[model samples]
Target: MDQETAMRLLLKGATAFFLDVPSGMEFGIDMMSWATGDKFKGIKMIPQGIHFIYYSATDKYGNTAPRCGFFHNFKKSECLVRKWDPDKEELLNVPREEIAQYKTNILNLDQFLAPYPFEEQTKWNGLSSLLTENVITTLCPETTIIRSAMELFPASKTENVKRRRKWGPIRTDDDVGYDHLPNLVPKAESQFRFTEPPECHYPPGSSLSQITKHSLDSSYILEKMAEKHHNVIDLLAELQFCYICFLVGLNYESFERWKKLFQLYCMGKDAVAQNQGLYVKFLLAVRQQLDTVPEDFLVDIVENNNVIYNGLKELFRTLESGDFVLGDDLKDVTVQLRRFLQQKFGWEFNGLDEDDDDEAPVIINFDEN
Candidate 1:
């Protein structure tokens, strides 16, 4: 089929009519973004799935505001209408009456709509395949909008204000003269509700031995987090959700949570043996996520003392240890990931050095009478 005919058929798939967005404003769906021209109205041929629609409003002086985005699950042949509020610099839902008119005039307006970039569909699918409506509703801010600069409010309104206020007069060597600065917290209604890691490494009333073990191996915390999910796949879904939020939405909070989740999964040696299927899926997800990371960011990882490398090494050691009889599927993907890392970043996972702090055994000395 000709390109025009193919686009026409795809346009019949799903359409978004973005009305009155200023020319030269940044607009994007999924992975590709472009500066809209005077004639641009919106996007067409969007595939049927949950996709992120994001844009930044450009001012008269050529200054651009922070990017804002939201997720929408489009259905086949569905039409969506959004009007850009120039004064507020935000996308607002069009009135139902006006939406009906746009639907009627879609054929006439088709010329102004840009076709979705199908070339990115495969990459987008790899990143977002595990994302579900449940994951969106659970983690997204109550306002259902994600902004690169998250909204914040004075810390006084937060639950931890009392504790934070108590530290106002206390000065630590690390304070660095910023202690006088007023504390701010993410707006309650605008914060991503990511699952927090455990506050305590061990359960209450645990013996000294159990506490020491839990602190060294995060399997107990992993088990605690697993109880909150329907299954292990749901846990993986949250990981994917955080990655997309950080990668596409530009939310650093999501990125931090993603690292924490990755660390939890990697550090839990017992959890790995208990859930082989989950580990297989986890390795696959990690590989795909690493593939998408920018080269500059990977360089930062190497510069920051090989944070990712160390995490993967710990995981590899756990899997390779003769104690566990791991599945072939798990072993195969693990090998593939190791090979990819070696070729891509020249990372080796043979073993940690005997003199390395991580490998050295801890010794507690006691004074004897």
Candidate 2:
């Protein structure tokens, strides 16, 4: 953006003031972090948009679960506040009266708040461009105050509620049945433990095998995939949500779930071959997300898991096949993404083909949520 626009954004930015945070607590907003200190408060001049603020409390042993944080979309000139509860080792709500007082005397409070590093605003803008207000509101309704994990219990399991830290809801079979081949359900271990399930499933009573049994054309299979709720937008949203849950929430389960979905789209020969248009659309969506992935998120994925790296290779190999055809726009996205992976991660993608016949099909359930 131009300097004039940048100045305008800074002038209309918001403030986030955290109070009573203990020393050694690793607190962060977006990709930045600061170890707590006595005089430290929070971040200021935050651009008006959706942002991920996360923190990990360190115990005596220095262990952190990293499964806590929240997403918020700030209105222009908003002053958001939170206080750390030492006893609970979590951020707690501040009283409305105190909030009002703090805002009224924000000039005094400014001394404690840290200015957002203006030099990083350009990078921040790139990282968060795709995280629109509508997307954040649709995915996270409790934006003002949401935790990565909240404890809850079913009516029958109320006695055990204390032991359960609910990350999210479990999915039902109907929500995931579309991905399976005809009459074949995945028998994988811990199948019930997926953080999130496949967002696309086979059409009602129709599996890949059953659909292929009829020898349907690509357009017909695309129709089948679209018969349910697995349109391109829903698929992209789930993809974006998974990345946030994994990178921002620091949830491994979400990382695994996302990888599985990525693999399903990029590796599932039957699906890709039968629904080329849908596959191309998904590839485009992935490319769009890859463009705006936060620096921290990209670092985490590259350092922690090679899932995306390997997936990219697989996708390129699949694209090279004569069976799959890409238009100019889709081809540009694929080429650009491949180049980005290479330049950013210093890894060459050789487009090596893989034999998928021997691989085990994954199956999982999904809750309506």
Candidate 3:
């Protein structure tokens, strides 16, 4: 649903959950961050308690507004998902407390449901749970876990049959029922785990070498021009090198491995420190998604560099996506690169060809207080 509709339909007193976090393990509902708004602090989306999602924005008083949330942290297996109430549209902090229990036969099924959201919800019952629950009625603390294994096939694994994660309380066999009445949760081909792609070698392309030299030369000029300022050209130059290093690190583990040794992650490694940390997390998440990706989506890069890719796209798609650019200073570089690509039959002849223009400046606002 559109963010607007989602806000309208989602219930108030709601919570969210993330199955993975603390960078790579399940996080609490209270720790999730709302996806909307200007608050720079971020949060993970909680995987459970999402039944409260509304299709349109509704204020605490039930008025309509934009929606968002912010998750600060997760602790003790409980989700502390922070949220943004659209009515006020401010970031909120919520903490989930973990409760421990033992396995037992139960009389009231709601006891099993009690550990879940106490309010109304959409139960996306995966086939593994659905099939298992029928044979066994008592759900101890252990049963609630959503196994990643069941997600591979659609409700039915048949061809032309679409797959889904969850269904509402009601189900029409027709919803996932395919021809021939095959089991809705059809068994799968032999499934196997995957290791990350082997790192590829990236020899410095001639085009990349030239651009690198040009960047350093440009930095020198900018340095001379801004002699009165803090003179951050060296810092920019280092960052530029780090960007290449990131691509190098991504393409080859050896390069990154070598980097980690001399790279004392204490104070001087520059942003590479954060990049290295995020890179590991990115790889892990990519591995998780690939576990069940539809065979149809094979070509999409699972290791989504969306933050870098979209940040660049934002400046190109619209002037309003961000206010990161400085006029004239970086504008000339954009014009030059477009002309070069047209003149030379240039392409990403090699990895890290230095194709992107650093037009959108990262504005680091110094705190005045």
Per-residue error for 241 in candidate 3, Å, reads 20
TM-score versus the correct structure, for each prediction: 0.88, 0.64, 0.20
What tens-digit string does per-residue lDDT give for candidate 2 at 234-316? Answer: 54445555666665566555555666667556655556565566666677656555655677867887787556765666667
Candidate 1 accuracy as TM-score: 0.88
lDDT to native, each model: 0.81, 0.60, 0.26
Q: Weakest 10 consecutive residues, lDDT, candidate 3?
A: 98-107
Off by over 4 Å in 3: 1-64, 79-347, 350-369
Error of 3 at 103 (Å): 18
Report backbone clashes per prediction.
0, 6, 42
Candidate 2's displacement at residue 329, Å, is 2.1
Judged by lDDT, which candidate is best? 1
Clash count, candidate 3 = 42
Cα misplacement distance, residue 203 of candidate 3 (Å): 30
Q: Residue 8 in model 1: shift from native, Å?
A: 6.6
Among residues 3 or more apart in sequence or in different chains, the pairs in candidate 1 whose N, CA or C atoms overlap within 3 Å are none
**Residue lDDT tens for model 1, 281-362:** 8899999888888899779877975657777887887788737899999999999999999999888876543235654322
